[model samples]
Target: MESIDRRLVHALQIDGRAPFAKIAGVLGISEHTAARRYQRLKERGIRVRGALNRFRLGHHAWTLRLRCTPDAGPALAQALARRDDTFWVHLMSGGTEISCLQQVKNPDELLLDRLPRRLVDVSAHNVLRGFASPGTWRGLACLEPDEVAALRPEFEPEPPTELTPLDEALLGTLEVDGRAGYADLAATTRTSESTARRRVEHLRRTGVLELRLDADPSRFGFATQARLWMRVEPRSLAAVGVTLATHSEVYFAAATTGPANLVASVTCRSGGDLYRYLTERIGSLDGVRETETAPVLRTLKRVALSEGEAFPCHA
Candidate 1:
């Protein structure tokens, strides 16, 4: 991608709903150019979608890693990907391992018991807290601090409210397209345009939903992506997690349960860059005792709002 295109993507990452004129002004390009570039990128499957913030909704999140026989990995991963609760399904370290994120109100024993018999090992780390997520990562370092601040939305917290069936229906539409116009939202939810607008605003103010631009890192010159699992001293876990979260290379960082108490996803220009990060950055952290890195071979499914749909699972 051209430098301007990259900057445009960064702008969208900061605010997916940023006006074309605003993005053009930030990138020192004409509004026409910005609009055209965005159209091209969207044609390639780079898109922004509204997603639920599970934490804000009081739901528990988990990082699930499954090691399976080579032949069974893809099928198992796909099965998980098809479920509404699972997101970020990935094939890592070749095709024998699967990694995914899931959010739910409570543990589902029935879901766990349905795992494929061919699985060799399975680990589900409860994500106690997140220091960074797609919405928070500063991966595109092209913009100035002021430029970034200009694109950010003014946040005003709202009181928590139970999600009504109408709200869920509205969310389902937004999940597919965050930039959907008020008319579209109103039509989908079968309500007045003013009512739809007010409800969506309330959801955003309360932090129950977030809109994020999802794009492949490789498209922005980041060719290597890896997942880092680190065992940190319990006392220093918060410090280490916070530190990792501040790095531009770190996309997702969270404190999790199990032996590897913290897990982070990082993107870099190459293997050498990843090595430097692990050695110079993470290795120097005070509480990091051991680290294991897994290269993401391919992503079968990326982040999406839970559709809350049910599917048959292997028992």
Candidate 2:
């Protein structure tokens, strides 16, 4: 990708709905160049979509790791990917391990029991908190502070509201196309255009929905990505988590139930960068007892929403 393309992606990461003209103005480029670059990136399978903030909507988010026999790994991973509850499925540790993210309102005891017996081991971690997400990470550090500031969306905290069926329908549509037109949303939900607009706005105000730009970090120069699991002393869990959250490389970090009390996903420019992060940054943190790292080989799914052409490569 060209430098301008990286900048464009960064700007969109800040505000997925920012107009091409606005982006061009911020990047000091012609509107045509900005639009053309975005079109090219989209053609290459890069996408920006709206994602639901399930935690904000009073849902619990959990990351499940399944270890299967080599013969059963791929099929089992695909099965989990097909489920409505699993949003992300990844093949790790040479395809014998699968990691996925799922969200639920009330913990269902039968949920795990229903899994196919083909799996050998299964572990689930509730994502108690997040330090960074795609929506928050500024990739490649390409955009200027002023440009980023100009593109940032003004978020007005809305009081929590109940999500009606109509609200779910609207969220589902937006999850596919964060920039979907109100007419399209209205048509999908069988509601008036004005009602569709009002409902979407309400969801956003209430923090039930979020629009995010999903792209391949490798395409923009960050070629290595890894998931980190760390065990921190109980007294320092909060402090360690807060500190980890402040790092730019940390994408999603949360407290979980497993032996490893904390899990984090990080993207870096190369193997050397990853080493520095582990040895210098993470190694410096006090109270962190143990750490394990897994390189993500393939990402079958991206967000907590249903599967679709929401990402560029997967789409």
Candidate 3:
């Protein structure tokens, strides 16, 4: 995309409600051009939507790293990509491990109970803590306007899903800005503010939509994030898993089939916090036989759609 388009994307990532006129002004383009560019981007499988800070909303988000056989890599990855429960999946470096994110109503117990049964060679962890930031398109942000325009035809989007008209419209508005006002949503959905509010409530109740604050880990003082892996006897899994899940510092956890039966992603405000969690929290847990850790140095792709008007796992 053009530098102007990148600027527009950045603006939207910061505030999805940024008016087209403002984006155009910032990019020295016309509002119509800005609008067209955004529509085009959406057509190209680039999602511009509201990302909920689910944790703040009383839901827990966990990243699960899978260690599967090389032969099973593609198969497992594809299976996960097609599952609605998995928010994102990636073949890690060397393709030996796959990383994924799961948004669960609760992260502690179910995460552990579900993994061994979910995939053949899955290793699990409730990441004690980790850092996260809203994904931006700066990398894909360099497309020129002409490039974006030229690519429009090839970028034809899949038709919207078979949702109610209101559901379809609400998804569109929320895709543009998760934090949009009820009045704004009403205008977009062609419904009254009260109706829009009711629609949003319904979406939430049905688990189709989640709204939350998106935080940047570095900005939040979690410069170092690591998934702490632990091995526990099957009998101790439940008691230990529940304890770790409810701990504020433990962001996500799950059970796996590997040596480290339990895995956790952890975040700390400082090095001191990290030291305390490992020495105090983790070390204190019984039935943990051995432990291993992998620090997430960088994350390439965060999440994707299993279905809908978003990025489909199929090519």
Candidate 4:
């Protein structure tokens, strides 16, 4: 990717709904050039999609780590991906482990007690707090400081909003294309364009809706991805999590229940890159007592739905 293209990706990460003209202005390029570059990037599997932050609406999220028989790992990963309740399904630790994030209001939805065939072990950790995610990751950053400020999303206090059927329908279209125009959104949700636009704003204001940029980290040269599960001293847990959230290599960091108090997802350029990060960065952090690194051998599902390409090897 060219410098301008990377800038565009960075801009979208900040505000997925940012206008192409606005992006072009920040990059000091023609609007058409910026739009064209984005289209090219889209062709390369980059996308901005709508997402629902159910956690903000009193929903609980759990991260599951499943260690299965080698032969069952791939099949189990796919089975989990086929369900709408699961996301971020990964094959890791020599293709014998599967990790996924799931949100369910009903405990029965988890079904952990009834392990599927060939499964050896399963552990589910309740996500207590989150410090970072792809939306907050700065690994793809390329814009100058001023340019970043120009694209930052505004924040303001808002009252709690109820989720209506119309809002759910509207979210359906956005999940496929976050940049869908008001007219297209209206057509899908069977409402006026003005109504569609207002509803989107309301959802965003109330923290129920989010527009996220989805792309392969390897496409931007950060190829190696791994999950770092660390046990931190109780008092410094928040401090360590806050620090890890800012690390360029980390895309997801959160505090969770279970043996490890903290977990982080990171991407690096190579094995040496990861080694240096673990030694120089994590090693130097206070209160980090023990760390277990699980390299992601394949990502079967991202935050959203499965990809169009042939499945089985990704991330």
Number of the top lDDT candidate? 4
Model 3 lDDT, residue 304, Cα: 29
Cα error of candidate 1 at position 229, Å = 0.9
Name the lDDT of candidate 4: 0.82
Tens-digit lDDT track of model 3 for 21-53: 766765678999988887765665444454333
Candidate 3 displacement at residue 175 in angstroms: 5.5
Question: What are the per-residue Cα lDDT tens digits for candidate 4 across 1-315?
Answer: 777788889999888888888888888999999888888888998988877766656666888899999999998889888776676778999989988887766656775865686888888888888788878778998888999999887867476467899999987777788888899999988899999999988888876777788787899998899988899999999899889878999988888899998888899999999999999999999999999999999888775565211111112
lDDT at position 30, candidate 3: 95
Expressed as tens digits, the lDDT of each residue in 1-315 for candidate 1 is 788877887888888777788888878899999888888988987877887666566677888888899999888878887876787777888888888888878877325678989888988888877787766667776888998888777867797688988788888888888778888999988999998888888988877767777677787778999988999999999898888878999978888889999888899999999999999999899989999999998777665632211111111
Give the candidates in order of lDDT, highest first: 4, 1, 2, 3
The per-prediction tally of clashing pairs is 0, 2, 29, 0
**What TM-score does candidate 1 get on C-alpha atoms?**
0.92
lDDT of each model, Cα atoms only? Answer: 0.80, 0.76, 0.55, 0.82
Lowest summed lDDT across 10 adjacent residues in model 1 is found at 306-315
RMSD of each: 4.8, 4.3, 12.8, 4.4
Decoy 4 TM-score against native? 0.93
lDDT of 4 at 187: 92
lDDT of 1: 0.80
- Worst 10-residue lDDT window, candidate 4: 306-315
